[model samples]
Target: MDSLTQTIYECLFGAEYYEVNPASDDNTKAADVLRALFSANEGGEHLKKSVHDIVGERGWTENLAKAILGGIENALKQGAQMGKTMADASEKAIAEAVGFARDHPYFCALIAVGVLAILMPWVLEALGFAELGPVEGSFAAWWQSTYRGYVTKDSLFAFFQRLGMVWH
Candidate 1:
């Protein structure tokens, strides 16, 4: 293995180099090793340390070292900016949703009721208020038998009746 490839391998893996003939040129081999390290989900700090160690040992020209370091810094800055942008967007969306909910209380209440209606069966089952047994027959028969008691008219009427009492 070439000196550059050997140095990179040692810095990144903390071991001696093993020759793998994937690339003909030294630069390609080095690039391939770096790419593999990244693809393996190696942490950024480890990669940065390896690169710094490699640069120091290789005795490259000052300009080349500056260029490489500048590129890494730029990439880090862009990543931070992208993360900030996403966080700001999420905050804005949440604020808008809260504003809409506050402005349209009745509409929000209706939507909540609709969502609760859809999720009530699973909610009840999770809370041990409803128990579902293994399927025994056709889909229609199972659905009917499973939900009939939980979703009957008396239960819904009682729920709304209680809700009305709470309002009064």
Candidate 2:
């Protein structure tokens, strides 16, 4: 009976099912309350199995079943709304990440280049380089040791200036 109540609650509220007030030991009243909750939205088929399990003891009529079905429809609508809200939040987060990356092309390229450099040692070792600790050390020691020296305003601008000169 307790299990039946829990199933009914979960079917109605989804995530917040456990947070709501549920009926205690009274199977009859629990069935009635669940019926009313379902009646608002057409939830009959959603909880049919749980209701069927207790029908004999709870004495559910056809009218009660119809009302429960109605409640299920309402619950479905609420679930859809929750899903939309989560989707909106995810879209906003992705948009912000894209905007930040767009505004910092040099930083983005540096991150990509750093990742590639870090992977190059493993790649080189796979291709039969025996003593390439210098390459590994270069990447590992970059940010922690001399990142500020290499990425200073004048230094970075100078590097870009050299690149422009080469390309031009």
What are the TM-scores, per candidate, against the unseen true structure?
0.25, 0.27
- Report lDDT per candidate: 0.45, 0.47
lDDT by residue for model 1 (1-168), tens = 678866644443333222433232333334443443334334457656665555456545544433333333333444422244334554587799999999999778656754654656343233222223322453423544556556564543334323333332
Best by TM-score: 2
How many backbone overlaps does candidate 1 show? 0
Q: Measured by TM-score, how close is model 2 to the native structure?
A: 0.27
Error of 1 at 40 (Å): 23
Where is model 2 more than 4 Å wrong at Cα? Answer: 1-82, 122-168
Which digits, one per residue and each the tens of the lDDT, describe model 2 over residues 51-155?
555555757565445434444444555653333433455458779989989999988876664464355534333322224222334433343245654545455
